[model samples]
Target: MSTLSLAGGPVSWGVDFADATGNPPYTEVLDGVASSGLRWVELGPVGYLPRDPGEARAALAARDLAAVGTFVFDDFHRPDAAGRVLDAVDAALDAIVETGGALLVLIDRPGEERAGTAGRATLAPRLPDADWARMIDLLRRSADRATARGVRPVVHPHAGGFIEFEDEVERLLAATERDELGLCLDTGHALYAGGDPAELVRRYGRRVEHLHLKDVAATVRTRELGFWEAIAAGIFCPVGDGLLDLDALRTALDETGYDGFATVEQDRRPGSAGDPAHDLRRSVTRLRAAGLG
Candidate 1:
């Protein structure tokens, strides 16, 4: 009955594609994670794995990895932008079904441009009441579509993105009916935004569809790091080494019976400035000790 699945987002691995974009083949890393005791992985974008679902499924099966979910990003809240967003969601849903993954995560567009100071000071506050309402409407429609396909739609609140704080997250959750939208809580981002991960889980456990298990090493942030830098650094540590309270989080998840993907998401790849594999092992060990695995 333990709801834990050994899943991760390999995009965190920091692989350089050279010219190839999307998901870099993590067969080696997938082997590492599975050996480290993970059971599944939430694959990155489409090409990050094999473009063909059969190939992707075979690759996962070969590595003993279950495809728990995948992510998509488009402006679903804008009426004029509906076509692309809808198409993207449909495509994502098809992939999930094809690969036998159960969840679909929706991330907010990072902003028109990745302007750090200007974004935080200006663009963040400009979202009018109407825009938020529109977002909710889009969420409802998307949720309906996902439900018809039997794939859960999880709204991911991001840090460094426009709706990146506690208030914004709360507003987003409040705006939608619980059945139509669930939270894809990213622990590192929650900590960066000063929200208690355990508290959010406890308050909204019923609406949790998936989780991004990560830690943030605040000391490395250098104080001068911008939003992306913080996002790049502040949110992708191995499990126990950062500021995230995983033990508390586990207790909350256990009590709530959240049987979904608790995916470790470290956007930075291994052998970067730090040892990603070591950090990941430490995280898995910690989660095991806490009875969360």
Candidate 2:
């Protein structure tokens, strides 16, 4: 049997940025995660939780929840922004280490030009060769820092970013050594990018160190909205409530012997209506039913 572990994150509750306006208190988000029956979670945006390691650990422990990883979304393609991006990466690494987490999920912040062309792989602009090299070099440096700190760094190919397409993913994998970098396969983003999540699992195998189990609504393809707008339009739904084939993904994970944390994420606009705990519970129940829990 596969040894995949189930987890959740604050993004399901619309907490995208730590200092974003109108975010719920961190304690409330933790309560919601625990109430939904999740014992593991990802540390959502850097400052969303306590900055002090001890305080952050105590906060999660208080809820009977532990962090599995933290994410850093920055513009890595710009050579000028490399320093700032690494600083953000270091911050995320700090959260991971202090919270007893093992993974640092790296995402390229969505660029304005590509934001509206999220799922239109052919329409999205490709980065110049020089910029692409810069991005890869930045990722490698980030991975080196993460490994030195005893944390694993995984690159997440997110929608509306420079690295969202399968070809880009292929290039990235080709550029980086497997020992220094790994992949975080997100189901909704994979589908949104016109790639099969299960197929990706089978292809990547052990190189996929982490998972984000999300469902993309079928209606999403019909909309002409930007990435954030699509999120507000409910592009991402609870697992099994939309187009994700949970059974196939579970089979792929089993075949690959993937023993990693699969986090349930239903990204929403901040202050969006609907009870986060309720949606998360439904997702957890679906994952259990599909034999992924």
Candidate with the greatest lDDT versus the true structure: 2
lDDT of each: 0.71, 0.89
Write the residue-wise lDDT of candidate 1 on 169-203 in tens digits: 77888778888888898887777666789888888
> What TM-score does candidate 1 get on C-alpha atoms?
0.86
**Which ranges of candidate 2 are over 4 A from the true structure?**
none
Give model 2's TM-score versus the native structure.
Answer: 0.98
Model 2 lDDT, residue 193, Cα: 89
Per-residue error for 75 in candidate 2, Å, reads 0.8
* Cα RMSD to the true fold for all candidates: 3.2, 1.0
Candidate 2 local Cα displacement, residue 22, angstroms: 1.6
Q: Write the per-residue lDDT of candidate 2 for residues 1-293, one digit (tens) a residue.
A: 57877888888988878888879888888998898888999999999998998999999999899889899988987789999999998899888988899899989978787888998887898899998988999999999999999999999999999989899998999888889999999999998888899999998888899999899999975687789989988899888888899889889989998988989999887798888888999999989988998
- Scanning candidate 2 in windows of ten residues, the lowest lDDT window is 220-229
Model 1 pairs whose backbones collide:
6-39, 12-266, 12-267, 12-268, 13-269, 14-269, 23-48
